[model samples]
Target: MSEITPELVRHLGELARIRLDDDEVTRLTGQLDAIVDNIAKVSQVATPDVVATSHPIPLENVFRPDTVGEVLTTAQALQNAPDAAGDRFRVTAILGEEQ
Candidate 1:
C-alpha cells in the first residue's frame, strides 16, 4: 500500500491553491495515492515492437462530374440597374481622389 500522510496532503493542497479540511485532505490523499499506483502499474507494460497508429481507417475523395450550361447575355446582365450612367454599371460620389 502507498503511504499517504496529512502533511503531504496539506502541502499538495497549498501548491494547488486549495484549502481543504483535515478530514477531506486525509481522504483525498489516500485516493490520489491509489490512483498514482494504478497508473504506475499501467506504465510497467512493455511496447518494444508495437507500431503507433494515429487514425483507424483510410480516406478517399468523392466528387461530382463537371457540367456546362447556357450563358446570360450582356444586356440581360445590366438590366436591373438602380443608377447606371454609362454602358457599364455606375455608383455614388467618391470619398477620396484616385491615386
Candidate 2:
C-alpha cells in the first residue's frame, strides 16, 4: 500500500484550493491512505473481462401520459407584471429586435 505523506496532503490541498490546518492534514492523510489501499485491493482483483456498469439494478423509463389542461386568463397573467399593456402583459424591449 502506498503511504500518503504530509507532502501529498499539501499537494491535494493546493489542487482543491483548500487551506488545511495541521490536524486536518494529518487526519485526511490517514483516511486517504486507507482509501488508496482498499482501491488497490479492488483493482488487483478486477480483470479485463469484467464489464463496467452504470447501475446495479435494471432501469426502465416510466413516463407520464401527455395531457392538456385549461389555460390562464389574460387578467391572471397580467396581475404579476409591474407594468402591463392593458389586458395583456407588457415587458421590456428585447435586445436584438429590428424596427
Winning candidate number (lDDT): 2
lDDT of each candidate versus the true structure: 0.78, 0.87
Candidate 1: Cα lDDT at 60 = 75
Which candidate has the top score in TM-score? 2
TM-scores for all candidates: the values are 0.46, 0.66
The lDDT, on a scale of 0 to 1, for candidate 1 is: 0.78
Residue-level lDDT tens digits of model 1 in 1-99: 566677888998999999999889878988988988888876776365755667667777888887877876767767898766666777765878552
Clash totals, every prediction: 0, 0
Error of 1 at 90 (Å): 28
RMSD, one per candidate, in order: 10.6, 3.6
Model 2 deviation from the true structure expressed as Cα RMSD, one decimal place: 3.6
